[model samples]
Target: MEPTGKTVVVVGATGPQGRAVTRHLLGSGWEVRALTRDPEGAPAKELASAGARMEDVASLLAAANGAYGMFSVQPTVGSPGTAPDFSAEDEVRWGINVAEAARAAGVEHFVFTSVAGVERHGSEVLPRNLVSKWA
Candidate 1:
């Protein structure tokens, strides 16, 4: 597809799902602004090389201010070395913050990618990470 001249903000753009979404969006010709904790990291650098604009989460809303869409994908809870410090409540809060920011920015499209079990079961039956996604 030709460049649509539209922009999409991709949160967690350093992670697997976020990277995929970023690549797809860029391939489809939408200007991609990737939000990440570390803009100097390798993954983020790769995205920038591929024509994405990298922005930190703190400044995401400003970068997405006039964007046409937003793709939100957060880190998984219990991820290998990072699980010990992960907080489900914090994850949920961050998700809410991103959504609210996107809405306030008047993004025409919002895509939130949740875990697999979230849609299949209630919160009580899911793990903390999944429950956070459900919330």
Candidate 2:
């Protein structure tokens, strides 16, 4: 892959998938602006990221400004290290907010990661954690 040296805002930079994506992007010569809720937290410190909340579109837009691309991956329900009160609806809302901010920031490239059993088309049996993914 060619290194474009472009900026790519990574939402959820401290999570499992986000960490891998951040490392890979950096290795590929892409500038990564990692977004995390707790900029002072250990994980954010380790990743050297900026602070941004998924619930705050303005903050997310600010963090994503001047970026050429954006990657969005929200936490799963009951995932390790996630808040106990985090629900499927919260995940959906967070994803939506991130997308909205990215669009508002004029991001040209947007990549979103979704879990299994997340069918946009109606499915009789959807995973509990992904029940609201397509809703």
Clashing residue pairs in all predictions, respectively, total: 0, 0
Off by over 4 Å in 2: 1-3, 49-58, 117-127
Task: Write one digit per residue (lDDT tens) for candidate 2, span 28-134.
Answer: 87878887666666877766633222223247888778899999888877766679888988888898899988888899999998775466446457665566666
Alpha carbon lDDT at 113, candidate 2: 85
Any residue pairs clashing in model 1, and if so which? none
What's the distance in Å from true for residue 88, model 1? 0.6
Considering only N, C-alpha and C atoms within 3 Å, which residue pairs clash in candidate 2?
Answer: none
TM-score for candidate 1, residues paired by index:
0.87
Residue 60's lDDT in candidate 1 = 66
Q: Which candidate tops lDDT?
A: 1
Relative to the true structure, candidate 2 reaches a TM of 0.78
lDDT of 1 by residue, 1-135 (tens): 899999999999888899999999999989999998778988889999999998977896797699999999877677532457888876777788899989889999999987764678877888765767666
The Cα local distance difference test for each model comes to 0.85, 0.76
